[model samples]
Target: MLIVTPVTPVTPTKTNFEFEIMNQNIVKALAGIMEKPGTTKRDTLAISRRVTRYICQQRRHLLTERHALRRKARKLRQYLPFTALAVADLEQQASDHNAELLEAYRRVLAAYGRSIIHDEEGIAAALGFDQLAALLNINPVHHEQAKREGGETLQGLVFVARMEDSASGFADEWGAGGPLFEACMAGLADFIRTCPDHLLPDPFAPGEVFGPKLPPQLRMV
Candidate 1:
C-alpha cells in the first residue's frame, strides 16, 4: 500500500485591489494639485479647494466601509471554505462604489476647468452678479424666450440667479469676487444645470471649445 498526500488549494486575494489602487491615485492627483501651486489651472484654486473638501469627506467614509468589509471578509474566510465567492461579492459592491466616486471626481474637474475659462472672460459680471439679490424674484419664465434661443442669453441670467441662491455663503471662497470669482459661479451653475440632479456635484455647484459638450451651449459651460 502507498501513502497519499493531500493537495493544497491556492487562496485568492482581495478582488478590489485594483479599485483601491485607482482610489489612491485619484487622491494623490487631487492632493498634488493642493501641494503645488501651478499644477492645476491657476484660476481654479478656490473651486479646487471646495472639490477637494468634498472628495476628502467621501474618501473618509469609503475608507471606513472598506476597512469594515476587509474585516468581515477575513472573518468569513477563516470560517468558510467557500470564502472566495463571498469575498468576490463584497468586492463587487466596493467596485460599484468606487466607480461612482471616480465619476463624480471627473465631472467636478471638467466643470471647474470650464469655469476657469469663463472667469477669464468676465461673464459673471456681465450677468450682473452684484445685483443678483434684486433679480432672484423675477419669474424664470420671462427669460424663457431667451432660454429657447439657446444663445446664452437666458442661461447667463439664470446662472446668476441660481448662484445667488445656491452658493449664497461662499462669496469670499469663490475667488477675489472678480472674473475668477464669477467664473467659479458660472462654472458651478453650468455643472448643476447639465449634470443629472442626482449626481449632486459640489453642493455649491462653460462655452463651445472652451466648455464641455452639451445642449444649450452656455448651459453646459
Candidate 2:
C-alpha cells in the first residue's frame, strides 16, 4: 500500500490581484471613454450617461472658475484706476480661455452625439423607450413620431432637435446657453440611470474607489 500525500490548493492572492488590476483598467477606460472612440464596443446608453454626467461636471467647474475670476476682477476694481485697466485685461483673457475650453468641450459633445446616431438601435434598447411607452400606456404611433420628426432624428427625443444639429447649432447653443444645456444633459443622465432593462453599471459607482487616475487632458483645467 502506498501512502498518497495531499497537495495544498494554490492561494487566491494572485487571482485577486489580477482582478484588481482588471478593474482598475476598466475604470480608467470608462473615465476617458471619449478619448478614442470606435476602438471599443461600448454600450451607447452607457456612454451617453457617462458623457452627460461629465458634461455637467465640467460645465459647473468652468462656471465656478469663471465666477472666481470675475470676483477677483471686481475686488481689484475697487483699487486705483490703473488697476481697472488691468482688471479689464484680465477679464478679457479669462473670457478667451473660457471660449477655448468651451470649444474643446463642444467637440467632445458633437462626437458623442454623432456616435449616438450611429448606434440608434443600441440606444433605443438601452433606453427601453418601448417598455416605457407600454408602462405609461403611450400610443406607438406617437412614440415613433416623438423619436423622429420631419426628416430629423431627435437627440434622445428631447435634448436636441436633430442628431446632426449637435455638431453645428447644438454646439453653439451649448457654448452660448451653458446653463440650459447643462440642465438638459443632467436630465438625460437621470433618465438613463432610472431607465428599465439597463445593463451597464454606473461609471461613478463606489466600487471604483481605487480606479486609475484620469489623464491630464481629460482633467478640468
**Which residue pairs clash within candidate 1?**
206-221
Count of steric clashes across candidates, in order: 1, 0
Candidate 2, residues 135-206, lDDT tens digits: the string is 223345455553443122223343332222222334335433222234444444544556785664564554
122-197 per-residue lDDT for model 1 (tens digits): 5435544333323333334434432332234223333332222223433334232322234344456667678897
TM-score for candidate 2, residues paired by index:
0.40
lDDT score for residue 116 of model 2? 45
- Among these predicted structures, which one has the highest TM-score? 2
Give candidate 2 regions above 4 Å deviation.
1-28, 31-42, 78-80, 96-101, 117-122, 125-156, 160-221
Q: How accurate is candidate 2 locally (lDDT)?
A: 0.47
